[model samples]
Target: MFSKSKCFVGGQIWSQTTRRITKWLKEVKSSTIRETQLQPTCSSPVYCYGPLLHTVQTAEPKLFKDSKTFVDMRMIHSQSETLDTFNKLMEKTEGKPSHEELKQFVNKNFESGNELENATLSDWKENPKFLEKIKDPVLRQFASDLNQIWPGLARQIRPHVIENPTQYSIEPVPNKFVVPGGRFMEPYYWDSYWIISGLLICEMPDTARGVIENFLWFVEKYGFVPNGGRVYYAERSQPPLLASMVDLYIKYTNDTKWLKDNIDTLEKELKYWLNVHTVDVNGNTLLRYYAPSAGPRPESYREDLETAKGNQALYTELKSGAESGWDFSSRWFADTDGSLNSIQVTNIVPVDLNAFYCGAVEHISNFYSILGNDKKSAEWKNIRDEFRESIYKVLWSEEDGIWFDVNITTGEKRKQFYPSNVSPLWTKCIGQNQNMVEVGDRVAKYVSQSDMFYYPGGIPTSSNRAGEQWDFPNAWPPLQGIMVEGLANSESQMAQQLSFNLTERWVRSNLRGFRDTNEMFEKYDCEVPGRYGGGGEYVVQSGFGWTNGVILEMLNAHGDELTADED
Candidate 1:
């Protein structure tokens, strides 16, 4: 549903569309999801309220009243002021009595249908237990630091707190997991992939296992993992990386017994992704960022509504970008305006989503082969081959020598230069002789020297100077880590060199930031390595999990090969 307002796309006035409420059916994990469409009878346009599962408003708090750990965290998010007061109160409250008193105070403020202005859920499990020994100073204690944060960031959900979006079913997830810190107090889908890398390096297999278990629980209960472990995020999913997370955990722990027990769930989850999120392009299906519901996101409502201007399609596309996890990046925009109004995310088919899916297929195929299920293994391998064949046909740009996203509607390739252009190569989708070799070659050529990409510190999200937080000048650890890993897999000397350089640059910033601030940040200012990043809807985040994860991972992966910075 789009507003009656005429929108613009590619310099053409978009056709006016109206909201049509239609009941839809879906197979959610334990609960059946029933979608209720809203149609307006009045002069105002239809403003449908998307159903949220496992939300405080939907579920009864009294159901979990008997649980000792169920401390209604939603109350703290009633308003920004209440959240500020809660954070301050938390500093004074330390014991059981204090916890109970704080709980009552929040309960007093809690009212049904009360505006939850912004639902930024954070769950920091009690205090951290310090690691007593550090054996390697050359590594600069990143692994040790992450290991310390692992326990303190653990959170769990009780069985009764389910928010099933439909009338169909309800599945329960009761497991412990780690958060990515800042306002993200809950587990995120793709963040777990990099976080598990550091967790394995730190030899904290249990915490890593807990993270995967929580996600598998989500797949079993919700049919797929949400963007993050929040009710408001149920509309869409982030990049599908649960298979990679499981691969990391099992590779490090030799936990074949657990893998054997969970292989059924793995296969089912893979089907959930392919069947549910797949886009049909000329009878060949590829993955894309998708959100089932249409509305301004509840979390960023004010901003979303303001940009949407009552256009339902634009609203859904913007929400799709949020699902991509590089939310609000200029990569999703049409041109240099860099305005949110320029976003039309649902139309593009991303390269990384396809590559990552290929990687997931490989993981599943290998897992099946390991089980000696040759027929099933071959079946999955064929599926991988079919999906891989569609990559270049749909996304590769010959003139640009880069893999770009496809505008799904117009069948046109978007040639915006993006770090994700390197993603297909990261998944080892190219080699010496294949046509994809050109893609690898181009990525190698630019990644080594692009000023827009390679900063003094590390690779920023994009070359775009857009003031958005996910754009230039902000170096995220996960992007840097992926570049290092991908380039390391390349056969070219330039690619290999770029791999080491990216790691060195990122490490310089990470080490310097830790030295100056005494804590890891969620993102870095590559121009001035120690400067905190800004320009997001919220302030700069601290105690950042993925930063700590990738820093430790890069150190472990390239530490011995590169010269160690002087301690």
Candidate 2:
């Protein structure tokens, strides 16, 4: 039912593209999912988003703290047998099970901790040269500890998972990779970009290459990377970073043969984004975060059901918000009420998403040039040029002095102070005619005027204190990386200093959090240094992959200059 619509951009007719709509249920109803019965097929609705999943997630008093605990657990019996037993149990309990009953059922029916095995990276070095660069003794020791965390975070899928994939939600990949740790036992999509960067910094190119190879496998099989390594995530992707990961991999390893071997898979990943996620804004093409899947996410099932309250549109929007990796953020909401019900993620084109795509394509072009394929290089270069122009034309707010996420329906700028506004600079998504020095000055001025420097922990995700994890008080690792790296890329000295100042605050916060808890966190409260973030579906998690990566990257960039002295 998708139809292309013509776009009028600056008095010129642009190419046609499909729009994301609120018909998730309609698509699901028409999909090939089995209408009834639970089976071992990954595509079976029963396993992914049907009665069994729903019943387990919504059990009275909740047997597990996180709903994801149930879905990720391996079934001890066959799916069909498990469903049949569950049906009989439900009938015996009149379809309403107590916490104890559910606990016993789960204990008897499933086994936990069998999906992934801890992998030891053979290339892990005890002391990389980055440690020598750090002038501060305390900070250097902290960085060393973070380096040690790599072994604990590295994971590989178990043989049973590959053999009996349908018994678990985790996706089976061919190579050993790093997981984000804690309850996140599977390799995620966007998190890997930072993880890969950290791996290269640690001088583990083979480990990094293995991680990228897994992503290539995902692109070959799913036509795009899933949000994470799980069957439930098959419906959507996080931000596109596969190409950027590969680009960094090549820079570190100089593995041209590897790049030449897998360049087609990289191209296929980019095409999936271009063909599916593009939107026409006044004839200009831009990308937005989207999740075409129906039903509550298997990981956050209970919370999504409660938030959506039977509204299928909200369910789709919630899923899209998850796909944005800023799950439950005020950035995606349509209203100022600060409620999840107001989320409308599919209605807006995000600046960071487009910048990531543009940057990725630019790398693709560079990668081709490296392989001496001038024709393909020029083709992607031309596409990259067009994308940058479109971003400037459609997302740049000249008066506001920054890029903004625009609403797709009304084509209006979402003027706000999310760190993502300056993401174009990090991705080098500027227009061809723009002066780098002036752009840098303007971005620096924007940060100063926004009072983003007021926070001691790091740059807050947004100016809004909307009680969501992505709003005020909370600073994410990736957003901090985006802001610091983006501003530093500017030719203006002020921007570079601003980037360093941010690095100091962010590193100090990571150090403080690690010293306080002996663990790294997923997000931190910028307003309160050393405090982990709050107000998400689950407790703020530790063993955070990207947080460690960003910290390591900052250490690599500013280790010699960073100090632990408060003064």
Give the lowest summed-lDDT range of ten residues in model 2: 23-32
For each candidate, give its TM-score against the true structure: 0.75, 0.91
Clashes of 1: 13
Off by over 4 Å in 2: 1-42, 91-101
In order, candidate lDDTs are: 0.63, 0.83
lDDT digits (tens) for residues 397-466 of candidate 1? 6566667888766777777666777787778664224544445567777665566655677777877778
Pairs in steric clash, model 2 = 8-282, 9-282
Judging by TM-score against the true structure, name the best candidate. Answer: 2
In angstroms, how far off is 482's CA in candidate 2? 0.9
